[model samples]
Target: MSPTNPSLSPERVRADVAELLGCDPAEIGSDDDLVDLGLDSVRMMTLVERWRAQGATTLEFPDLAERPELGHWTALLTGSAA
Candidate 1:
């Protein structure tokens, strides 16, 4: 697998999210709701743990679940400490 969005880049987040959803990166709009694209609580938590391991310590499952959009997560994850 390719590297994930450890740096929290918007594009990288979108790509990673797309991969997690088993879709093409182009299919994920910046504001598209991830849950609508099939993201469940387990998957959301998995993503949170992966990102946290990659240094996105501030990322929380609830935050991502509340706003499952690339742009929103990008903004949130970008502020996280390594």
Candidate 2:
């Protein structure tokens, strides 16, 4: 699954995060803090591992935890993270 694929878009990422957190995708944004949403260290680790298995290399648990937002996560998944 390449980032260029529609399945890896920010909207998809947002949806995935929403699903994991049990919230609506509209509730997440590019700057939302994931820790504030009830995602603990364990769950964050699971999410990172899942992303890695799905072919994402730029995103780690720390990065996602630090900036738990759709845009940043999408960039990481797409290999556009700085």
Candidate 3:
């Protein structure tokens, strides 16, 4: 199943990231750097593919990797980012 919800919340993003990292959702801070948390290129690409398949087609691995933070990703996914 897709990690993102239809509402596209930051919490969902955090949960997805936590799952990928084999951690808890609470462990993933909204502003935490995923790369610093062991999020490598392969995992990042996997997330991109999964999210894209769930309709986040504009999501790019580079974009996510550039700033691997749940808050920013949530904003991008929900069209709330500047």
Candidate 4:
């Protein structure tokens, strides 16, 4: 993937989130709340910035923070559910 246009797939989202959470991607269920897993604002902002830099230009902090679920994020990033 290029620096300005990332292929934000479900697996990639899971991997990125899992990497920050210190857990395996498979361990995170689609309905699981990321905040419950210790995801703070700092980490969330990190994702927003990362995804934005990777071409998620319209992604905002509240977009993810409003619903911190794997499936929700997957759809938001990739425009489809896994």
Q: Tens digit of lDDT per residue, candidate 3, span 1-82? A: 2233356656666677789899988877778888898988998898788778777766777778778887777777765531
Clash-forming residue pairs, model 3: none
**Candidate 2 wrong stretches, greater than 4 Å:** 1-7, 79-82
Of the pair 1 and 4, which is ahead by lDDT?
Answer: 4
Best by TM-score: 4
Better of 2 and 3 by TM-score: 3
Of the candidates numbered 1 and 3, which has the greater lDDT value? 3
Task: Please give, for residues 1-82, the per-residue lDDT of candidate 4 as tens digits.
Answer: 2122347877888999999999998999999999999899999999989898778888888888999998988888887774
For candidate 4, list the clashing residue pairs, or say none.
Answer: none
Candidate 2, residues 17-38, lDDT tens digits: the string is 7878899878776677767887
Sort order, TM-score high to low: 4, 3, 1, 2
Best lDDT among the predictions, by candidate number? 4
Single out the weakest 10-residue window by summed lDDT for candidate 4.
Answer: 1-10
| Candidate 1 lDDT by residue in tens digits, 5-78 | 44666666666787889998888776778888898888888888878887777667777887787767777776
How many pairs collide in each candidate, listed in order?
A: 0, 0, 0, 0
Off by over 4 Å in 4: 1-6
What TM-score would you give candidate 4 relative to the actual structure?
A: 0.90
